[model samples]
Target: MQPPTTITRVLVIGAGAMGSQIALTAALAGHTTIVQDIAQGRLDAAAAQLRESTDKMVKSGKLAEEQARRAHDRLEFSTDLEAVAAAADFVIEAATERLEIKKAIFARLGELAPPHAILATNSSTIGSSAVAGASGRPGQVCNLHFFNPVLVMECVEVVRHAGTSQATVDTTVELARSLGKTPVLINHEVPGFVANRLMGAVQKEALALLAGGVASMEDIDATARMALRHPMGPFELMDLVGLDVVDYIAQATYAATGNPADAPDESVAALVRAGKLGRKSGTGWYSYSR
Candidate 1:
């Protein structure tokens, strides 16, 4: 089958924050987009979040009211993976950051999606190479990692593994641009890709400083913002991205590399154990009233 030159139908598997935002981005770009999840409750939550996000955009004058309405109209939410995958021209697996879960989804997508469909993942840490083999279409599988708050983040990492085809990489880059994102191509697969790897280094140092009593989290964050000219300190950014997510990425990296230094910091693990999961949970390095 000839590689798909254009993406018209998009299937986003998993209706959490990242998945929902990705579906919305496709719909806003005028693609027929469906957000699929196993749980109806998660789909319901995703739909509500999409509505709230679009409304905020409209209110902020970033999106026209009519455009937002049309984008919403283009989006569909469902629990039927087979039906959606069967019809999708592009399938993006945005499930939890677990290798097993992603491999399972790709295995299914490999069986269900059209031959020309390009399967991608929104994983922040786990490289697509680890999951691509299960898809039975490694040439068409790549990582399309989007940052948190997908609508606002301009950078989308288009990562290609060794088996990924040039056509697939080009098509994925075009797709990212169509969604109004700036695509950064990573010719080789690496843990955390580009942005996250740099961010991870900063996070590790920040955690070490906090552990050593070199400074408070607030002071460290202040140093980053004031001295490094970063918008948010590493700790504050981790909170925004969700501490649980940070920990998960850390664990995934350590598992992939088997390096103790890559493991989740003790402080992060302790907070996650206590259910303090950052902004989503209303607390992490800092507390938020929710």
Candidate 2:
């Protein structure tokens, strides 16, 4: 077992957009990073995406060529969860944003991972307590919520639930720092903790405005970018994040908090129902080239 002072190996469960990026971030930070998924296709796609992103960064001068090369070299792909988890010093599950699914994953990790391993989730809406109890080692399970596009984003929310130990929080905070992220410590667990809560609130209000005929989607986005100085308007950001993802987060948050205002409006629901999922599906709040 590696010393508690350092995490030499990192395991990222899931090979989806967020998971692959999280693994890449860990690898680039000089950790041996293993990314596992249930399907071989997802693992293959993740490898391809990583290669493309690494090349783009090198070309854009955001990353040194040698560094990008080394990061790629450090990453390993697998379908065997137990084998990878057993070897991992830290495990980050960037799987679907559903409470039950997360709990199941944590339960398995608790059984397989080394006693000292820290189990983390990259969930946006769910709190750590939702799965920490299922992990068996609640003190070692916390939420290390890395933002989408992990390499580009500088912020990570390190959340501590009621059962989370101070040592676990401290180690996770240092882990975030090592990955070049500014870790925001959240002492209490809350649905949509910090940034996501703020963003979700804005999205909820923005959707309400559109549903009320207060403004056109374009006008609302324009106002945010021009008047509010937001990097991208709410609708644009939603589209980028995927309407399906937005729908899931909104629904999950509402279910957890029982806040009617947190619910997604009819427009968001309709789009998700129609499978206009966003950039991935080629259409959502706006159209995109496939």
Candidate 3:
């Protein structure tokens, strides 16, 4: 079977914030999109959130009423992975940042998805190569990492593993462009790809400063905004990205490299252990009224 040259039907496996946003992006781009999740409750929540987001966009004049309606009409939610995968021309797994869960999902997609379907991961830290073998389609497997708040972020990292075909990379790049995103192609695989790696380095320093009492968190954030011209401080960004996700990425990197320095900071870990998972959980580095 040949790789897909054009993707018309997109299956997003997982209905979390990222998956829902991705499906919405595809639908808005005129592709038929399906969001699959194990639980109906999560799917229901995702649908409600998508509606709220589109309504907000319409109110902000970012999207027209007809366009939002059409996008919503083109999007679907399902719990049957096999059914959706079998019909999808492109499948993007946006599940949690866990290797075991991703591998299992890929393994199922390998058996269920059409041979021409391109399989991709939305993982920020775990490279697609780690789960590509399980998919039985390494050449078609690559990373299409979209930043959080997908509607706002413009950059989509299209990362290829050693076995990923140039054709697959090209197709994903085209798909990203279709979604109104800028695609940055990475010829090789690395933890965190490009943006997140740079952000991680900055976050490490920020955490160190906070730990050493060099400055208050608020003050450090102010410095980044005022001096570095960054719109948000490291701590603020961490809250938006979810502290649990930050900890998981750090843990994944540390496990891959076996470097203590790559481990999650004690402060971050403590917050995560306390169930303060940033914006989604209503608290992290700071509290938000959710």
Residues 1-290 of candidate 2 have per-residue lDDT tens digits of 22275899999999999999999999999999999999999999999999999999899999999999899999999999989999889999998876788899999999999988999998887888889889889888888998877879999999989988888888999999999899999988777789988998889888889989999999999999999999999999999888887888778778878977777677888999998988889999999987
In Å, residue 208's CA in model 2 sits off its true spot by 2.3
Best by lDDT: 3
Q: TM-scores, in order shown?
A: 0.96, 0.95, 0.96
From the highest lDDT down, the ranking of the candidates is 3, 1, 2
TM-score of 2: 0.95
Taking the candidates one at a time, how many backbone clashes does each contain?
A: 0, 0, 0
Give the per-residue Cα lDDT of candidate 2 at 92. Answer: 96
Q: Which of the two candidates, 1 or 3, achieves a greater lDDT against the reference?
A: 3
Q: What is the overall TM-score of model 3 with all chains considered together? A: 0.96
| Model 3 weakest 10-residue run by lDDT | 1-10
lDDT, candidate 3, 137-249, per-residue tens: 88989999998889889999999999998889889999999999999999988767889889999999999999899999999999999999999999999998889888888
